[model samples]
Target: MSEWMVTQGSTARRRARPLSPLREYLRDTFWFAPMAAMVSVFVVWVGAQALDTAIVEALRDEGDYDTLDELLRFAEDAKAVVSAVGSAMMTFIGVVFSISLVAVQMASGQFTPRVVRIFVRSRITKATFAVFLATFVLTLLVLASFDSVDDPRAVTTVPLVQSALTLCMVALSLLLFVLYVNTTLRLMRISHVIARIATESFRVAASMPVSTGGQDDAARLGSATAWVPHEGRAGVLRDVHIARLVRVARRHGVVLRLIPRIGDFVVPGMPVLAVHGGPVPPRRALRYAVSVGVERTYHQDLGFGLRQLSDIALRALSSAINDPTTAVQALDRVVQFLAALSRRPLDAALHRDRGGAVRLVQPVPGWTELVDLGFTEVRMCAIGSPQVCRRMLAGLDDLLLLVPPERRQPLLRHRELLRQAVDRSEPAPADRAFALHPDRQGIG
Candidate 1:
């Protein structure tokens, strides 16, 4: 009877370790970069100021009086320019990002709220903000380093190095602004959004192990004991710490099965993982392996990309928007996502240890689930648009050729559903028949 219990030690005493909020904060927040920029500016200022002082001292020793006078004049003149540049950057940050953020909010509304997340996580967006702040700080430091010609205090005659660093930062800030504007503009374009999401999906797919065939032993863990309960704030399961879990499981010579799929909402007290084939190891290790956040991320959740694409298509098909053209464009990427995976081997669920023994069984989405997730909602909404209808049919047909025969069932079922939807959408015999014909380019 004791053997049936997943945990061997006292259950009440041990608790699972919650994933690090600091790690998640760094991963998902917008302010980290700008805050980091402040620190970076100070560090650079220290080093560059030292160099400037050393160079000034050496020049004075060499009796370079003419160069010293010129540098002093330049430093005096640069004060106002640096001051203006510093203040202008502050205004630039507030105005540019405020407007861009508002635009991002609009894009999120038009597509999915995921757009804002994508925007926040963008390296260019972060870099632009960081550099802008760094430049502003650099200017401020440069201004401060300038000697008061009125001061009878110890002062570096020429703040040449600090000024040069300021100029470089200012130039970089300008270059990054161009990139930020371009990226923001691209976010507003539906085609670009879809392409970006699809590109991410492909990147995730490329990391996952390609499935040749069966994960036969995967189901052996079905009757396993649910051992670990979530100990943190309830939210969407973002991703699992796969390497850690596998390492721990291999050490214990046990198999760990994740109970919830990535992207599933997990609440406190929910079973995080099931212990299969052996005694549960330390609860802390298992608990720390999972990350839960307010919303889903694309890191390990393959469906998120398709979900975003479908959302765009659905929004385009809405009665208010009634933009079938945009809907068709969204469907283009949906087809591309399915088509890419159709030919390539899908991911395997059973994660193996270095010794080739099964250590973890992840609940990866099967082809059927992927098919349903990719096409189901759009199919229902797309019926009214002949453009969408024809494109979907053509897409299913293309997937049929790419997938193996055993994988053909779902595609055929979707094809049949589309035919039925066309029948219902086009009451006229000729119209229904025309809509049934597969065309990748919609009407063309």
Candidate 2:
């Protein structure tokens, strides 16, 4: 391979790492807790040693006063103080972790398993655990200093300053513990989770590249050309490096059509992309240009966020859960996300290189497909529930007003489907009529 190809391959691999759930869990902030604790312990030990030297020198140079006497007393009781701090910190760490684990378990059970990812990735939770562990490590280090210098007349026997600093840290940890509790409570709510997902999906939809409705020159070329199959393990397609793929395509003087859009699963022996030109780019270079993972991430996959909220709503509407209110809230957010999407260009599937030459042609779901993904499953689950049916109809009607003329047809179609669902599910004409019309509370 050429030097530039090697450089591009490395860079693409770095950017296109598949953020699967296990990878995400291992990469979460809590995983760094031990490193934080070790660093804290090292710094605290160095600082304590320096302070011990300074205090001993000050006492030696200056006559002993009442303040000096108090310092001496603390030094004498340094082991006890360190022991107490270490013990207390250990207890606090256990309590905090227990509470956090309980919250995660409750969220996973009551909500969706996907919701647990939010808590695991929480900065507050990670910082809480890191600080708590650091405090314990610092105390143990301070406690070890007692064996280093045992003579009262020594020039490195004072530990008052270190003890005071550790005490202040304890206070900070306690404050963080309170804030963590508040965050846990807020995250447990269904509305907050749906809103967060909606906001993120909106941002992702808006960030998609704009296209000029240009056709790929390689589209015709790929029909008779050789295809490049994925040679890696099976996984979800998380991201694609369009720029690098374009560069490779341009360099090879051919058009490449990616077989899978973001979030689709691909396995070894499946075609990853089809080549238009005779010879394809290096296999390693092309493989590095795409990211595959065990699960999907919202980074570049537009379907992921919508799928999460839809799944949550569908679960809520299930007979086992039977929480129509939660489903309604999720539908409300879905409507907001669809409205935001309608304003953006959803047909930007053609990607070009730096020279504005189209080299990559991949399929992105049009607005209609997205609408179907967001509403289809939820509507099916809501067929028997008047509250859910009303909410879905109202959402579709509201979306129809916001969407452009081209997009309004799909919304209208979904609305009719919802109306039919109400007709079939509600036998009484009066009850069915009430649900067929969009109402805030589905009849109330």
Candidate 3:
């Protein structure tokens, strides 16, 4: 790899997520969205109550007896409906998500465990959960503040605004229920599942800036000191506070080359970065710039998206499933990601100081490694499935056309291996010839 530009902005002003681990947690967990909705529901309920009181007072000043009687009668009618919503909404929430969870589980099993992460990260799933929670909680709050009760001793008042708001919530809930069901059903279909994963992978790829490699900078800054983990156990490295690391390196008058790439596992006491010249920064400062988790995430790990796409393909190609068409579908996405990625420059990252001196260097996957990751395993697993074999050949041929001549070797190598696999697996010349033929739609 040659030289590359990682960031165009001033290193000090560059965006950084210091609390990325916590942010990632918010993205992956199921409870946070509904919890936020529960809190917001109270605010909406309070505003409705205040509005109702103000309107009632205004009506009484004008002595609008007929209008007041009409509103009171409507509120009385709404009480029964509101009570029904309060009871039904909670039960509905439990039942709906329960079934959704089961569906999610079956999809995950059918595709890959990574689909569960995608499910939790889905914007629709989160929004549906939040709205349902808001509707349920808001209805309860509206019910508790009901002023037009049936008790004779109780002073009666019409909660006009509350009644309307309650009805609106019910209507929205029904509308969202339809949408939720549609979304849940789509999740079960194989095509939609792979397409969704591919879409997410593209998002991750777009977030990454074009680069070549930062090893040249690291080479110039020789004889470095190592900064090891300050505390905590080992985990798969997820996020790095890049701005903070640059700041620390600048302050210490040293260059930092991150030792482990994102998604690389690091144990305690292992070197996190090599401090090239100058004294090492405080342990806490360096430690604070890094975060580790039990599992890999798409937050910064670009390969994680490919890993997920590949997992689904592998699962479909498994002996138990024996579903080559599904594998072909996954390969279609994998090829798309690879083809798009190949057209861009990808190597390592560079973080520079205010003076334009490279202060931090982080290595990323090169094109060769990425090509291997995308095709190597799939080619091996495509043995008995002629449809998958044809699709893999088509994917390689498509990539060869999209990428430059220098990047064609990886594709060509996979091509040879694929042909050999077909020759070895299929004894009949007709089947082997069919498998060797490149078909984008597999058998189609």
Candidate 4:
């Protein structure tokens, strides 16, 4: 067994380290959007310049009077073409931006507000923005070369080929805009949203290794320990640097116990980590390894995805919305996610160093806790809603059939709880019986 003790005066207060600069820079959709557009602009400019130079050289070699005149005439058309493209692309950018903002607003109001981050981070939206912006820049660059033709002192040059390239870019942007519209429409649908979240949550679950019940053959933490107090402002603890913590603990030959699980919040003076043998490592190094952010992320916090759908279900169940069907759809996703989680072991995790020594002990939510997190609140909020309650019962049955028998006990208990809730809150005996029967389409 692990012995634990914290000295009263041993708590060290240190500010949580800020996120790495490079990571912070890359995570923002705004940064990547402009950077991609700028790179595209540069590449298109270089290609256009090369093609224009080759055309000038070819024209000089031929020195054909008729061809020169035709080339000059084409330059006039190229200028008009590029100018139109530039104006049109600028307008398109504004229109698409407005549409994206409206879509985001609707999604936030309909679903959970956190999902707005998903829309902004969408690759389709970013790619569309990049292509349109790049087209605008290419047009401007082509227009700049028009002066080369007008100048008598310089060798006669025309951007006939580059203008054709700009025209091609215009066509590509239009195609992307069509796809963007399709993606936006899909985002608006409730079924699509629920499915997307379930798929992502399943992916996150698949990435973890099967648990050995978190048992460790190595020694556990002794009574003597140093408590590492939380520093800085409070926020969700999104990730832990278990590997690094293990390495540091092994180097000092001590066990480090992290108090909060991923997705937990830590405020000032909370014991974030307990060091059980050596003095605590430098505050900055330890803090750098732990990530605390404004909101929960899917990187390692699997519960965040479920929370997103749960919010949508709760919103739909609101008095103003009163959309039971939408809540039922959300419950379908909840069942899928919980079924996936049921296959894996969820217990306190123990990470060891290369030397086979237990260096890090971090707490994790067990299956019962996760089941409660995923279902309790929504079921409670959905008490009188027959469609929602029946859907929940059906989901519980499906999950009971899907997962292994060892996991079936909890599902069985939860199913009983749902029945009891329906019995108490639902006044109609016939309605309660229908909900208790577990039909996918609910009482209807």
Of candidates 4 and 1, the better by TM-score? 1
Give the higher-lDDT candidate: 1 or 4: 1
In angstroms, the error of model 1 at 362 is 0.7
Q: Rank the candidates by TM-score, best first.
A: 1, 3, 2, 4
Off by over 4 Å in 3: 1-19, 57-67, 147-156
Q: 100, model 2: CA deviation in Å?
A: 2.1
Model 1 misplacement above 4 A: 1-23, 62-64, 150-156, 211-215, 343-348
List model 1 lDDT by residue over 366-441, tens digit each: 7888899889999999877888899899989988988889899999999998898788768899899888888988
> TM-scores of the models, in the given order?
0.88, 0.86, 0.88, 0.85
> Cα deviation of 156 in candidate 2 (Å)?
2.9
Model 3's number of clashes is: 0
TM-score of 3: 0.88
Candidate 3, overall lDDT?
0.78
Clash statistics: count for each candidate: 0, 0, 0, 0
How far off is residue 310 in model 1, in Å? 1.0
For each candidate, C-alpha RMSD in Å?
8.2, 6.6, 4.1, 7.8
lDDT of each: 0.78, 0.75, 0.78, 0.75
What's the distance in Å from true for residue 422, model 1?
A: 2.3
TM-score for candidate 2, please give it: 0.86
lDDT of 3 at 259: 80
